[model samples]
Target: MTLPSGKWRLGFDIGGTFTDFVLHEGTTGALTLHKRLTTPQDPSEAALAGLDEILAMQGIGPGDLSEIIHGTTLVTNAVIERTGARTGLIATEGFGDILEMGTEQRYDIYDLFLPFPEPLVPRDLRLEVPERIDASGRVLAGLDEAALERAGAELVGAGCEAVAIAFLHSYANPAHERRAAAILRSAFPDLAVSVSSDVVAGIGEYRRTATAAANAYVQPLMHRYLGRIETALAARGFAGALRLMHSAGGLIPLETARDFPVRLLESGPAGGALATGLFGRAAGLSDMISFDMGGTTAKAALIEDGQAAIAPEIEAARVRRFTRGSGLPIRTPVIEMIEIGAGGGSIAAIDEVGLLKVGPRSAGSDPGPACYGLGGTEPTVTDAALVLGYYDPGFFLGGRMALDAGAARRAVARVADPLGLSVEEAALGIHKVVVENMAAAARVHIVERGRDPRDFAMVGFGGAGPAHAVAVARALGI
Candidate 1:
């Protein structure tokens, strides 16, 4: 399987809200854009369907395909929703509760009821083997063979199809982790095992171990998803190899993805940055911010001098929207961005103080906004956009999904009357609130990095980003 000589490179980004397809013809430098409703049930199905439709429209066959670059939020969703396989963690004795203990830093030091994200692996599912590896990567206590056997048996008995083995300081010394993995493999040859040292070599024990655990948690799902995609592509007469875009905005072979599934956590956002980078260059902008508001979340990244900012560590599934140390920290190369639940489908309601509040909870595409007529009675950011004139009810998604403005008004009215504001004012307030939320997040992220928002131009994409960019920029005082 190889790429064709032609300049036909296809880039597909399967976002939480929409599946975007871009066909770039090397010959003419011409681009064709296609957007389709995402099929979360099987995201690859939407990709395939979108691919076929675009190929048909361009009158090109599979033979004309040079390369296909794809990205999705499948791994992120799996981890955030806790919908991955029943997984287990294997650690050195006395350190089995590392993940549970975490850094022990409170994001809200003064708040009494500070909530924490649940550990990916439960305590009972976290098995400890009789082994000790010091911070210097030296084995102070050798692995107890009998204890390993018993732990493996217990994990297997607990129905752990996948297990993560993260020994202390394994990044510096992997001997103990390697030995434990060997023992587990010998005992349960079919079980999937992930080691922290190999996945993330960064310092910070909790983040490294958490990253590895998250990887193991989603490994089986990624394997099945990628395999299914390969099969579907082969059946479609696309004989070329399939490459997945990683969170770092580079294409990695399927083998790499299968082994380090966690790297794809921010894959979808990476593609958006790549797209934004290309657009920025074309538009003669060197420094810019990429704002992507999809269905499930809103992602923002800062791009300076035609390069997207990248961070080596980021938290996932944060309990608090803007709080640091409030989520599982993963040590991986990812485009630095802040994600908030302020997407088009973000639910809007009134807080306890009778003040209108926008979301960190989304309606998703299943029921969608009340205007979608998909049985969703909740008022969403989309509904607010419809009422605020930012979205033309008849021209949304190029008129693919007809919206009911009346429904949106009614949904907004449910919360508007209590706030003593008209439906239009309430909808506008919702839009303002969401935009400010994104702007505030960007400001904090940029300032914390010792940069200024004014130094970056905002490059907006996704369904709602373009609509809210101006307001968000104004709110940021840019």
Candidate 2:
């Protein structure tokens, strides 16, 4: 690829704990990197702040950039934290419960008490209209426009911000779904809508509906977020093209992403995986494991033949973090990765079994770790790392931000005193526990594919990846 002279491009990723920015001068091929704690209230705050800081550090304006590529965990976090728009699902008559019914295959067949996440759309909001389409693209029953209008009215009356249209056999023939979407949009101009056929053209009643529902659930939020970023950049005199990273390790236009927000489920992780593949290939390693440990979670993906694996479908908002079917299954192409609930911001506590457990829960960037001195009292993996001398408190973010050692000690002591151990011991325990958790996830992800962890090199990314990479690799005997 030849560089366009004097042009600049920026790439940024918004993680749970931190937002990272990279400014590239296209002509000189120079790279400038910056990292800052994320703003949970409005993620774009951190993104734009980081962007301005980076550009200022390079003595350049936003208009100097020709393009900006952004990847964020907003959609994934919204689904997990249930902070997305209040969405309703409009499905074929008598099939409104497909989201709840699922595939009937338990994620853990041996475990009698299996848990699945609640549907994004509640039963009351899952309205049904008179519509049916057979598997062979034949319309068995024409769509009832009046029924759809009534359903839309009921949903809008109930304060629905977005709506999903998934009629039976819509994959074979999307006429009903399209017509229903058009009607809803025409009636409720402010409502964001997603149609199953538009989101996924493949066949699978439950999967298609779930994917569209997921898209609808986050459509409004993505729209607002992307719009905010664009407006902010334009205000800074930016005339560059803004592209969003999707879950499939590809870049898509802002409009396309907003319409199909479900594809952005693993947007951030996919970027990391793609980078891993690129760097791995550069290092002459065709087969490796990409380990990205950030604030909320650690994701591991296999890079074979210098490419990341793409899964046809991915689960979101899993009740059990590591359980395969304990989540809402959305049929969309995504970079296949195993996510472990162990990261820098992951909370640490003693489980009901009297054993120390690291999270499926994260402090995120709001209060962050206890050491951040942001009113967080809970002990997080970052606090443990600080207490164990793994991170220099005063030197954090190159002294741009300070970590409180006393706060870290106090936070770790809560767990240490209860376990009858010193604070340092407890911190070490926290660190070791998280490392093992990541190693275990990576082991399963690799071995299940008839490959050995030792055979594949481990390429680490994210804030915590490098810190725990060696320990995790050793734990996996790699």
| Every model's TM-score | 0.94, 0.97
**CA-lDDT, candidates in order:** 0.85, 0.90
Model 1, residue 63: what's the lDDT? 62
Q: What would you estimate as the lDDT of candidate 1? A: 0.85
* Superposed Cα deviation of residue 371, candidate 2 (Å): 0.9
Candidate 2 runs further than 4 Å off:
1-6
Find the candidate with the highest lDDT and give its number: 2
The weakest ten consecutive residues by lDDT in model 2 span 1-10
For residue 6, model 2's alpha carbon misses the true position, in angstroms, by: 5.5
**What TM-score would candidate 1 get against the native?**
0.94
Model 1 lDDT per residue over 1-478, tens place: 3334865778888877678888988878999888887887888888888899888878886666868888988889888889998889988888899998998888888999989999999999998878777777777888888887888889889999899988777887888788888888998997888989889986878888899899999998999888888888777787665688999889898999999999999999898887788888999998788888888788888788899878897788888867888888988999888874388888998998887788878887777789888788889999988888778888776776688999999999988888888999989889888887788888888898788888777777788788888888888777
lDDT for position 128 in model 2: 89
